[model samples]
Target chain A: MNDEIVLFDYWRSSASYRVRIALESLGLPYRRISVDLLAGEQRAPEHRARNPQGLVPALMIDGQTLTQSLAIIEYLSETRPQARFLPADALGRQRVRTLSCAIAMEIHAVCNTGVINHVLEITGGGEEVRVGWMKKFIGDGLAAVEALLDNPATGTFCHGQAPTMADFCLVPQVYNAERWGVDIADLSRVRRIAETCRALPAFQAARPETVKPA
Target chain B: MNDEIVLFDYWRSSASYRVRIALESLGLPYRRISVDLLAGEQRAPEHRARNPQGLVPALMIDGQTLTQSLAIIEYLSETRPQARFLPADALGRQRVRTLSCAIAMEIHAVCNTGVINHVLEITGGGEEVRVGWMKKFIGDGLAAVEALLDNPATGTFCHGQAPTMADFCLVPQVYNAERWGVDIADLSRVRRIAETCRALPAFQAARPETVKPA
Candidate 1:
C-alpha cells in the first residue's frame, strides 16, 4: 500500500474542491482522476463500485477507498496531525464541526445538483426555477453562517486564525454561492473568512478554475 | 455546570432523534424541551440564540450549547471515551463516519421537510408530489446504506458487535423512511442493522412515539 493517495473527483465539484485544499494545505501529494460528472461518468458501474452514492471525490488512500468529503478530511487530518485541520479541545472541535456542517448539510447538500435537478423535474421549471431555488437556499444558509461567524471563537478563519475543516467546507460553498450570483457583500464575516482563506496558495491552488478538467 | 445536560429537540426531527439516542446510549440524563417545529417555535428568538441555525436538538452540556447532531455526538464520544460511540482507529473511524454521513448528508439533509416544502411551493405539487419525492430520495439513500453495510466491517451494528455513531444515524433515518412510506423490505442489510439497533432500549426510548411532547 506504499502510501497511495488517489482522488477521484470532478473538477467543478465543490465537495472535491474541499479535499484538494486539504491535501494541498497538508502538502500531501496524490494522483488525480477526473470523473466527468456532467458526462455521467459518476454513474458508470466502476465508479459506483468505488462509491455507492456515485458521488464525486472518493479518495483511495493507504489501501482504502474513502467516501464523503468530511470523512476523508477527518482521515487526512488524523493521519497527518501536523496539518491541524481540527481544533485541539472538544469544544473547539465541536464548534468547527458545527460551522462546517451548517454549510455542508444546510446549504450544499440541500441545494446540490441532484436535488436541484429533482426539483426541476417535479416542478417542470427550467433554469430560472433552478437558479431561484439555489438563490433561496444559498442565501438563507449564508445568513446562518454569518451568525455562526459572529461568535468570539472565530478568528482569521472559521476558527482561531487557522483553517480547519470548517474553512474547507466554507470556501467551496462560498464559491458556489458566487457562481449562483448570490450577493455575499452583506455577509461581512463570511466574506472576511473566505477572503482570508482564498489568499492562501493552498486554497488558490484548489479553485475550480485551476483544477477544472480539460 | 453541575454535569447538566439539556436537549432542545422536537419529537419527530430526525436530527434531534440522533442526539437523544447518543445521550441515552451513554447513560447521560438530560431534560428535553420540545421546539414544536409544527408551530414554528424553532424560529422563536430564544431558540435562535441557542443555535443560530434555529434547528432542533441543541444540547447544552458543560456550560456550552452545541448544535449539529454529528458534532454533538462527536463531542460526547470524545468526552466519554467509555461510551465508545465511534471506532478505535483512524480507518475504522472514517468508515463509521462515512456510513453515518451517507445518511445524514445524502438522505436526511437532502429530503428535509423544509426542502420538501420548498419543492412543493416551487413545483406546485401537493402531498402526492411530496410523498413521491420523499420515497425517491429515501429509497435511493437507503439503497446506498444497504450497500455500505455489505462490507465485512459491518457486524450486528453498523461497525461491530457494539453500536457506533452509524447506528445512531441509521435508526432515525429508518424511522423517517417508514414514516414516509418508503418500503425497505428489499434492503436486508439496512433492515438487519436497523432491527439490531432498535432492540436496544436506548433506541426504543428515543422513538418519536416515546419522546413526543404531551
Candidate 2:
C-alpha cells in the first residue's frame, strides 16, 4: 500500500501553515501541493473539488482527504499517539483544545482574507485600513489569548512542556501578528511562547519565509 | 458531591446556543446564568475570570470551568460515550469536526460581535451597514457550508442518523442567518437539515426566543 501523504496548501495561509507545522512536528514526510490563494486558485472548481469550502490545507493521508486545520491536527493526534499532539488526560486535552480554538476560531478566523476584503469593499478603504484591521483584531485577540495562558496548565508551551496542537496554532498566529505589525511586547507570555516555538527546527521549517514559493 | 452544572451564557449567542443544544440532547441538566453581552458584561473581570477569553457559554461542569463551545461539547462527548457528539471512526470524526469547524470557526466566528463592531468602527457605517455586513459574511459563509454538505456521509443529521457536533453548530448559524435576513432559499440541503434539527426538542428548546430573558 502506498503511504504517500499530500497536503494542498498555500504558502502564507494560517490554516495551511497550521497543517504544515503539525506534519513537520510529527516528523511525517508529505508532498506539498500549492493552491495559490492569492491568484484565486482556491476558488476554482478544481480546488473546490478538493475542499468544498475552497480553503487551503486539505490533507490527503491514509486514503482520505481531510479538511479543517484543527480537525486534521486532531486526526493526526488520534492516529499517531506517539506524536502526543493532545494531552493524555481529558482535562488537559480540553485546555489544549480551548487554547487552540481561542486563536483559530476567534483571532485567525476574523482576520481572514475574505472578511478583510469585504471591509475594504464596504469602507472604500486602502492598504492602510487593511493593515489597521489586522493589527486591531490580532492585537486584541492575542491579549485575550495571553490572559488565557495565565493558568497552571500552561508551561514552556501553551499547554505543557511539550509542544502540542495549541503551539502549532499559536506559532502561525504570532507570525501573522508580526506580519501585520501588531505590537506583542506587552503580551509577555505570548511573546515568550512564540519565541520558544520559533527556536524549534520543526517550527522553523514551517515558517512562511521558509515555505514561501521561490 | 455538588453535581450542579452551571452555564454562563448570553441569549442569541451562537456559541452559547451550540452548548445548550449539546447539554439538552445529552439529557444533562444545567443552570443558566445570563451574561448580558449587550451590556458589555462579558468583558467584566468576573466573567473573564471564568473564561479568560471573556466569551459566552463558559460551562461549569464536573467541577471545572470549560470554555469554547466546541471544546466543551467535545469534553461532554468524551466523558459520555452514549451521547456520541462525535463519530466513532477516526475518519468519521474528522469529517464531523471539519463540518463543525467550517461553521464555528469560519462562519460564526467571522460574524461574531467583536468583528462586526470593528467593521462598524472602521466604516463609520450604522445599522444598515451592520446588517449588510452580517448578511454578506453570513450569507457567503453559509453558501460554502451548503456546498460542503454535498457528501455521501451526510444523513438525517450532519453525519449519520443522530445529530453530532456539526448539527449543533449548524442550527445556531442558521438561526443567526435568518435573524440577519440572509436569504437561504437556494440552500436546500442546509435548510432541510436545519428544519429537521429545529423540530427536535433539543434544538427547539435552545432557540434564542425560547431561552431569552423576559
Clash-forming residue pairs, model 2? none
State every prediction's TM-score relative to the real structure: 0.98, 0.98
Q: Candidate 1 chain B TM?
A: 0.97
lDDT of 1: 0.90
lDDT of each: 0.90, 0.91
Model 1: CAPRI class: high
Candidate 1 residue A103 C-alpha distance from true site, Å: 0.7
Model 2 residue A202 CA deviation (Å) reads 1.1
Clashing pairs in 1: none
Per-residue CA lDDT of model 2 for B1-214, tens digit only, reads 5789999999999999999999999888899999999999999999999988878989998889999999999999998867889999999999999999999988888888888888888888899998998888788888988888898998998898999999999999999989989999999989999999999999988989999999
Tens digit of lDDT per residue, candidate 2, span A28-130? 9999999987898989998888898888889989988889999999999999867889999989989999999999988998898877888889889899999
Instruction: Mark the regions of model 2 whose C-alpha exceeds 4 Å error after superposition.
Output: none
**In DockQ terms, which candidate is top?**
1
RMSD in angstroms between candidate 2 and the native structure over all alpha carbons: 1.1
